[model samples]
Target: MKDKQVLEFDLIIAGGGAVGCLLALSLRSCGLKIAIVEASAYACDSQQSLHPGFDARSIALSHQSASYLQQLGLQSSLLENCVPIKQIKVSDQGHLGQCWLDHRQQRVEALGYVTSQQQLGTMLYESVKDADDIDWFCPDSVSDVKQHQQHIDVILSSAKRLSASLLVVAEGGSSPTATKLGFQSQVQDYQQVALVANVKTDHPHEFRAYERFTAQGPLALLPNADSSFGLVWSLAAEHRDTFLHMQNSEFLQQLQQAFGYSVGRFVALSQRNSYPLALARLARTVAHRSVVIGNAAHTLHPIAGQGFNLGLRDAQCLSTLLRNTVKQDGDPGAAPVLQVYSQQRHQDQSLVVNSTDALVRFFSNNHGPLVAGRNLGLGLLDLCGPLKLKLGRAAMGYGGQNAAS
Candidate 1:
């Protein structure tokens, strides 16, 4: 490649998904030249467009994550389309164990907010689209990543080469660039698939989220802005086809049977989609001048709805470190800077990943002893103020000090 033909940037983000976009916006005011290479075309304005990351799926954002976005001047745009989650009710099917968490108890207006991925993507894209320091390379993907001593060379699908002082991979768990760069990940299949769709109920949701653990797996119903709920039902791989192919009424019946009538009857449902559940984490987040974040760094179970929240935290912490690096006239991709970012993120990532995995294993089983223990534990968690407070803080992405250290 000719020197002039190669584009140069201070930071090159490998994906244009939620995390990648958030990172770009987070560092927008840092005055560093940043480029985001996305495989999907720029489709932030329309939900009809098929973008891998910005889909019709609704995402739950922790209060802390919302605060981060607000800091980036996205509060007004996002709040218009979001549903505040004032309360969360968790229970096990056919069991007496239950726990309720209220935002009031935590002295917060809401525990979190739920918004469609499309809306969030639009907000993120609009926030940095016109920034002079940021370049969005949509409809292009990083085909290869070559790490050098001080910078990384990225080859795009368009046969264009770019050099950057830092290469941050925010691609999803199935990123080919991560694989081609020899980044090793520890993966565990939950033997389950998540069926997701939007459902209308007979009664209003009242901004309450429900987490019901059934014999098969966990099912979450997040309140939506239209008085409906976004359903995330985890089913064993063997039964996914049956549920997916069932008539709407049949599926609603099964969902009602499993979830009770907490939010009234499920009157209708949109198109359903399923994806396998797994716990995937890169063995190491930092490699030479490159780093991995978001799903590329750690992909967790959806039992607690922490996957995106955790990824947002990853972006937030990295952005803080990078901002400081720029202020100090240091290389963004230096080993010391990357190591600090990695260490700061380790605790938060491990806590959320392991806890989410444990929740899946503990709640998915039907063994009598385990069931009894989980029931007792839930009761205790509900009755214990300090324990509940700690759990709530963690869920809201405010528990760990090491995340900012």
Candidate 2:
């Protein structure tokens, strides 16, 4: 593209998935010129599944995440389709120790809300679709990036060139552009796969969620808006194929045997999909005039459901910093601005990453002593009101309160 043909903006966002879109929408009031370059072409209906991350997969939005979205004016639109998680029950299969969390104890209306990724994606997309200050470059991706002292240049897969004060990569953990930009992530392979599906049971979920840690791994059943349960069962990598290929009835039998009849019999299930689990985190989320956000910066294990919530906080913090920069008429991509953002987010990022990794490693094993210790810990947590409150606050996304936006 000719120099004259290169588009210009104050900010350029790579990846138009949930986190990217949320970041863009979060800055709508900042009056900055924004462009979103998405690799996948978005379809009118989410069922077509054209967008990569906006599939039927369910996601948990912690109370803090919901509040953040509400601050961005998204709660009213999303609440109708969301199923509130009023309570959470955690137990170790074949163990007597258990822990229960209730909204009443936490002093929150609900611990969190469960909604499909597609729903949140569509809402975020729609919010920015018609914004005068925002532009979309769908069906295109950031192929290369060059950061200059004052501005950054981006070349899209479609051969379009753009210049911006800053570049934010929200393309997720496996982002190619982030790799090209020299962002290194420390990754830990869990040696497990998560089997996800929507399951119908004989009894209603009643806005309750269950986390049952078995010898193999943790199994979670989160209530869905349709009254079905969204199931995420972590299995050893070697057994992934065996379970995925099993007949639905047989799989249900195995599931029932493992999870017990607490939620009643699992009668039917939707299509099953499996994702390899891993923990990926960048030591530094910012470099020069560019910054990495969302999964591109850190991807945590799903045991705590803190992945998206943490990313949302990244967006929120970055937006707040950029808005302040705008108010001061300063460059959004200035090193000082980016450094402050990285600094403010460091504590929370470490808390979630380390804690989630710890949970995965600690609970996924069947060691005789460790199992007993965890069970005892859970039992003590239930009996100890102060400790339980702390856990509940963490679960509600307030554990790292220092970085609150």
Q: lDDT scores for all predictions?
A: 0.88, 0.90
On lDDT, the candidate that comes out on top is 2
- Candidate 1 lDDT by residue in tens digits, 218-318: 99999998898999998999998999999999999999999998888999999999999999999888888888999988888888998998889889999
Candidate 2 overall lDDT versus native: 0.90
TM-score, cand. 2 vs. native: 0.98
Against the true structure, what is each candidate's TM-score?
A: 0.97, 0.98
lDDT of 1: 0.88
Clash pairs, model 1 backbone? none
Error of 2 at 169 (Å): 0.5
Model 2, which residues run further than 4 Å from truth?
A: 45-47
Q: Which run of 10 residues does model 1 get worst, by summed lDDT? A: 43-52
